[model samples]
Target: MRRLFPALLAVAAALAAAFLLLPLVALFARVSPGTLVVRAGQGAFRDALVVSLKTSLIAHAIVLGVGTPAAYLLATRRFRGRSLLVGVLELPLVLPPAVAGISLLAAFGANGLLGGTLDALGLRIPFTQAAVVLAVVFVASPFYLRAAIAAFEAVDPRLLEASRTLGAGPGRTFARVALPLAAGGLAAGSSLAWARGLGEFGATLMFAGSLRGVTQTLPLAIYAELNVDYPVALAIGALLVLVSVAVLLVIRLVPSWTRFASIWPTASAASSSR
Candidate 1:
């Protein structure tokens, strides 16, 4: 029975691995290099790629800029409703894609809560490229914020005190000490946020209307092509698979790289002393 238990566990693990990998394997196998090359040159693929890259990058920048400080505050402070605020921010992470889209519409749509204010300002959001960016930010910022908070929380409070004792202010200590210690986590979180933004679909489609060269991202392009141009969809899926693999690899390696970087100066100093 003991031997059988280990064997059963191995079989289950193998099955899980196979189950996860089979779809990716089939996708890559179906997408030939020629098909990818051909699709890459096509207007639909090119335009969607450009839009996806542009919107996702812009969204990533926004998330990092706004989310980092917000995350730091949430991690360091003990304020009223802090937990509630975090839960609200993280709500999008688990919300159904369709629900997320509707939530955005309810908040920003023509007759939504902010609609009259936006109208007074003559600012249109729905069915535009800006809407796509907003949707991406709405869904993706939480990933970064969650990760950044965790990263910030992991920093040594003593190190923070030491910096303060050394005459550093809050901003200086965070910028010089806390941020460097948390770089690996920040990178991993930023990559995840960027990937999430890149792959945003339902929310973007609902808000941005999927117009090619305007708001159609790669995932949206894949959806638009799935029925009419299956081969192109396959190519885009392959591209996403590749990008996802690279992101996962980076997430896995970043900690090791950070550790090595942290130790290198110490090792060099020891060698010089010897």
Candidate 2:
């Protein structure tokens, strides 16, 4: 039965792949290659791509910079309500993007709870590029944070001790030791966040108006095209799938950074070695 396990898993995997592939195959089959080309050449598509790339990058930066400290604290320390805090951070991960959109509107919309005060400063968040970034961060950061926390948790504690004994500062130890070891997981998680942010539609549509070059990203463009141009929508749909697959595959290619970590077993290792 142990030897037969591989065959069983293979069959399951094949079925899953087919399920995903069939829809893509059908979508492309319905569109002419020429039409796909024309859709790609359009200004809307280019603009959406640019907006997506820019905001997603900004969102990811915020996640990485903020999430690192949070993850590290969670991994190394514990207190009452730590788990609750983590859960709160992760709530957006499982939330429907549309619901998230509505929530954002309630908080930041023109007539939102704090809208009047913000308006006094001439600040408008909803239906703008900044709103899109907030939505992306809300929906996508949890995905990255969950993975990042796990990665930080997996790091050996002893190495941190050893670094301290050697007079290495906290910043240096994190940069040279902890971070290099967790690089692969970070990369994978970052890519997942980017992918989610890229495909985000519900939140983007609800918070930021799908105003072509203004608020529309690729996914929004596809949603818009679907209403009036089925072929164009189909083409963009196929493009999205292609982009997602390409990104995921690239992330999976990163070799593990665990080897560097394996060399450190404890904080006392540095002193003992000498």
The best candidate in terms of lDDT: 1
Model 1 worst lDDT run, 10 consecutive residues? 259-268
Give the Å shift of residue 172 in candidate 2: 1.7
Candidate 2 similarity to native, TM-score: 0.84
Model 2 / residue 128 / CA error / Å:
0.3
Regions more than 4 Å wrong, model 1: 1-3, 263-274
lDDT of 2 at 19: 100
Residue 74, model 2: Cα distance from true site in angstroms: 1.8
Residue 155, candidate 1: Cα error in Å is: 1.1
- The local distance difference test score of each candidate is 0.91, 0.84
lDDT of 1 by residue, 156-227 (tens): 788899999999999999999889887889999999989888999989888788898999999999999989
lDDT of 2 by residue, 42-119 (tens): 777777778888988898899889988788788778899999999999899878888999999999998999899889
